[model samples]
Target: MVKIYGHPFAAFYWKVLIALHERNVPFEFLMLDADHPQHGEAVARLSPTGQFPVLIDADHVVIESAAIIEYLDLHHGHAPPMVPADPRAAIEARQMDGIFDDYVMAPLSRMVFNALRDTDKQDPHTITVAQGTLDKSYA
Candidate 1:
């Protein structure tokens, strides 16, 4: 069985989960807190970057959501038929994924974390910047 070390609230983690689910790949989702001793050591052993959403197979370990999703698509033949048989479409999909990571996920994650810890600690300027990005992203 494959295992995925993930946190449900994590953007990248959920992205990987969605990919796996879309591919109908059977995997165990191991909910992990990056700071926890058990998860930290295991994640480090699996991922050189020590990141979440590490996919562990019986013999091979892979980190990074994009890599994992690509692997699943290659092995499972499970992606939607319209998901780009063309090389350019594949590139577009990857590019859109990167846009989400850089623009949407990153800022939203920071804002959420800051809000969780202390709303006052969140800079108003940063929120304004993120909101502008958000608006642009949706539009």
Candidate 2:
């Protein structure tokens, strides 16, 4: 069984979770919160950057949502490949995925993270810039 390490509310985690569900792949979700028993140690052991949405399959550990999805597509056979089989189509699909992740999710993630910082340390200008980027991407 595959083990997924992440917080439920994390967007990247949801992205990988959705992919796993789409493939009907059964996995154990290891919710990592500050309060969780294995939050500090286990998560750090699995992911070097301390990021969520790490996938563990036996002795193999996969980090990053995009990489996890690709690993799943390669290792687990399911209906409708996450990335198309054709080289050109696959390249386009991956490119679009990168655009969505970078242009859309990246700004949103920065804003959310900034919001979580101490009020005195928060940068309104940064948040505004991120919002503008998001708006432009949406347009």
Candidate 3:
């Protein structure tokens, strides 16, 4: 089975997990503490950036969430792909996905973990800037 090495609550990890889950792919979620010794080895072996959401499929290693998600969509064509097949539709979908990753994903993610830690108070300026970027997502 494919094994994903990552922290459970991490946004990038969750993104890859969600992509696999949405594709109905079978995978083992190996939760890793950032400070763990094996975590460094796990990351160094796969991730160029020493980051989480590193996927181990047998002996092959895959890093970066967008690449992981695209691989899932390509390999598991049984499920409807996130992007439309048409050239324009695929281009637009990719653009929107980028905007979501840039805007909604971060601040909205802060809302999730910060609520648990009681840290990272919401910044109105950040929200306004995010909203402006989101508006461009639809353009």
Candidate 4:
């Protein structure tokens, strides 16, 4: 059985979930939390960076949402392809994916992280820059 280690609220987890749902893949969702017994250790074993949304299929382990999606599309024959078969089209798709991740999600993530920091530790200038980047990306 395929197992995914991640939190439900994380956007990257949602990205993996969307692909799994689209592929109609049956997977066991392991919600990772420091409070949960052994969950943190297990997640660490799967990911060196301790990042969420690690996919485990038997002895194979895959991390990173984009890589997970590509792995699914490649190995799971039943699923619709997430990436194009043609080299040129695939390159374009990956480029666009990076743009969205970097321009859109990156700034939003920075803002969220900033909000989570202690008030005194928070950087108003960083928040302002992130907001401006988000606005520009939207425009």
Mind sharing the TM-score for model 4?
0.90
Each model's lDDT: 0.79, 0.87, 0.74, 0.85
**Model 2 CA lDDT for position 31:** 79
Inter-residue clash pairs, candidate 4: none
Ten residues in a row with the worst lDDT in model 3? 110-119
TM-score of 3: 0.69
TM-score per candidate, in order?
0.83, 0.93, 0.69, 0.90
- Summing lDDT over every window of 10 consecutive residues in candidate 1, give the lowest-scoring window: 75-84
Model 4 clash tally, residue pairs = 0
Which structure among the candidates has the greatest lDDT?
A: 2
**Candidate 1 residue pairs in backbone clash:** none
Please write out the lDDT profile of model 4 over residues 20-139, one tens digit for every residue: 988888899887776685777888777889887899999999998899999989876476687788889999989978877888888988889899999999999988998898898889
lDDT of 1: 0.79
lDDT by residue for model 3 over 45-120, one digit each (tens)? Answer: 6777887788777777888787777777876536777666688998997887776677767656655544566346
Clash number for each model: 0, 0, 0, 0
How well is each residue in 1-139 modelled by candidate 2, as lDDT tens digits?
9989888778899999888999999998887876777755787887888877888899998998999998999897476879888999999989988988998888999999899999999999989999999999899
Q: Ten consecutive residues with minimal summed lDDT in candidate 4? A: 75-84
List the candidate 2 regions with Cα displacement exceeding 4 Å: none
Ranking by lDDT: 2, 4, 1, 3
Candidate 3's C-alpha runs over 4 A off are 34-36, 107-139
What is the Cα-based lDDT of residue 24 in candidate 4? 84
